[model samples]
Target: MKPAPASAPFAGPFALATLSAPDGPPFPALVTPDGRTVDLRTALGDPQLTTRHLLEDWPAVLPRLRSLAHDDTVERGTSAGLRVHAPVEPRQVFQSGANYRQHVIDLHVAHRAPGDDRPEDERRAEAAEIMDRRAREDLPYVFIGLPSALTGPYDEVVLPAWAEQPDWELELAAVIGRPAYRVGVAEALEHVAGYTIANDLTDRAGVFRRDMPQIGTDWLRGKNAPGFTPLGPWLVPAESVADPGALRLVLKLNGETMQDESTKDMIFDVARMVSYISRTARLLPGDLVLTGSPAGNGIHRGRLLRDGDVMDASITGLGTQRTRCVTEVTP
Candidate 1:
């Protein structure tokens, strides 16, 4: 007889790391009993700690790490947690455009397909659309930003006075734990260490990066504004994710649900994106892959963020990230 199928695992108990507000030092982490303020970075960086060591091994070390969280020796707190930051620092960031069919249709309509629909006009439109798409697809929409743009879990996002067209995109960010290149989709997940939520903040007003010639069209200026990216509350272990494609994702502005979606809406899917992106550039350990966002973006309505706007994005299993937007003159 075949061996009985193994039962699914559960982290009935676990420890999480968070910042020690009053202390402000990186050596020690403030633990949260209910998984609130746990710092995965501090936990993973500590050589003397066994929990961090097991995390490096993943499923093999999961059960034992779960047991350790129950120990009273771990420092615990109800609050005083520092604002969260993006879980990993990536060397390069690539974003997808119109990755959801609904978003594609919306973007197309918003721009009015650019021409009349007569038979001859239709043929020309089709050709142009194909050309435009091919040009963009020939290379994944790539952009670079500094780690300075990254904000912590509950950190406030500042909307610079120059960015009047601020918008929020709720996306799923994959954290690569292993370096990979030309890996098959079947084996791509192995290189992923975990997942988290990322808010790809954009400035529609076009003033954020006017110094650069290409500032208006793509992400360089729109995406690289200081405090434009708000990420994390948790860096969920991959094993805890039941099905990334099935998970429910959501974004809220000041307690108002704005973007509610499912990972199932993705056009390229996770593995295919990883496979395709890796073929051109080597994906190093700690790199981040930000999957595309779904529809309901504020840009569709010509509405942009102003001062005092609060935004939050959450993926199932990965937990929620909350950011408050504040506007101020550039220093």
Candidate 2:
């Protein structure tokens, strides 16, 4: 792990931290709204408090812990000094595709066939109709990602030599706190533990299957490179985030803003994504369901990633992340 200079000013009532001392091992911590921390093990009355262990028992012990947040006797330190790690090791990570109407519109409108003569308004209308059909049919394109691809919020991303068009996708990730199966959309948000920011780095060139055109996208080869997912500096408890749909998400390359949009632009909300996924299989306590990204990606800007580039991402009330790009140095 390396130092990521960006710090998140958390406005949530309660938050979680998976971190260590400047030179120590990883452990779970309880973070306050003022950026102070108490070891979760001590607060939870257990000597062993791995992130997974805490999350697995959240549904049972949340009340006791919520009460502990008010105790002034617990030892506290500034969270700014701590070396934060990825909040949890998810058993499954589900990513949504084409869930942002404007993002899909940018992808479709930026590149048109030479002979095509469709007007901009007509093209946008067609795209809007497609999103409408998706919501009406309750069909969301969800894909699985390897847990091993995940890294801390500020970790270095090693761009492969073969990946010529590495891109950044800043998204809102919902952490599952309870076991859920076939849950209704009305009650799906209850299954969420908290919220965190994620930079879903991608290799644009490999998004489609050129050799096997009929197979569609090849996410494994294109998106799952090591350190492809740079996750949170903190986890704000679900209750603290009143409305996930109203939050603003942003991403910057170096110091220039690339993506700027609100969660309101999403074609399907967080509850719908969770409810749709649980219908096919059981959702575990630490599973991550990533809502899709908005527009202003590198492809739309006509500028892809390069060696030594730095990316900074933030979501309102969630947190901030800073990552530097480097070419993979070893085989």
Candidate 3:
């Protein structure tokens, strides 16, 4: 993929995007109802208008931002189409692992247990039991991701030459608005400022630690490659989404639909995942909770990402992303 043209008009479902104007610097821009771009920094008259600031003061900023979205005639730039940057420069990114029910089932079916020769139905039944136990215990598996891995939603992804099996995991990332610690599910949603799309690219072949068996998974080595996390075409405010757990996520690889599933299939919804994580870590404003991806990944289809593969991923009302896979030249 090539660099974005100087004038890629901001016209999409994104409520707000951290973007830079042509020949200008970067800032958070709000997309008005009439498809105009209002630099949040200028609109609010604050040079530091960023995702983190808006999120921390969302309660007071919401009304002001909402006002701008309705009145497009309030002196905005029509031709100031901006290019997207990463939505938020998060300090902490908590990513859920295996939070999608169907995705887990798909993985289990694809990699069956050896020698047991148990009936398929029996295996599925056991998996279901495990899921139930985990849910009931309020135990959700989550891991940390490096903020340095983030890139713009429309950026091209570079696959390391040594990575044999690269894959994509499209997920809905919840932007934390308020500081939360040990919050319960009932109030978890209160901390979310809005939502965005994230493509958690993975190097499938490096997911496990063969030499360090006791250590298990290695997300940092397999998932935290530069540009591995392509985030946001925009961030739709939390109020805009009627139900956080009722959205659909779709992904296409080279124009072929690879992932088509809904957030309804989550083993633990956004609220639960957020609340569960808060028990241990202090989630600050702008931190992201990437509620795991849905089914239909490259590994399950017996196909993996390669050079020149284009990924078009989108979530209901959040926005779409066009990520091209490129090969990084080995030194």
Q: Can you give the lDDT of residue 19 in candidate 1?
A: 35
TM-score of each: 0.76, 0.93, 0.92
lDDT of 1 at 25: 43
Q: Write the per-residue lDDT of candidate 1 for residues 46-94, one digit (tens) a residue.
A: 5344323433455555554454455565434443334334555566666
For candidate 2, lDDT tens digit of each residue in 1-331?
4543434466555678788887888888877766677887776677766887877877776776676678898887766667778888899999998889899888777655457799988887888888899989989989988888888887888898888789999999999999889999999999999889888888988988778878888899878998899999778788878899999998999999999999999989999999999999799998899999999899889998888888889989877888899998866
Candidate 3 residue-wise lDDT at 104: 81
As for candidate 2, its clashing pairs are: none
Number of the top lDDT candidate: 2
lDDT of prediction 1: 0.62
**Candidate 2 clash total?**
0
Candidate number that wins on TM-score, 2 or 3: 2
Q: What's the lDDT for candidate 2?
A: 0.85
* Poorest stretch of ten by lDDT in candidate 1: 1-10
Please give, for residues 188-291, the per-residue lDDT of candidate 3 as tens digits. 99999989999999888788777876787889888999999999877888988888789889999999999999999998999999999999999999999999
How close to the true structure is residue 18 of candidate 3, measured as C-alpha lDDT?
79
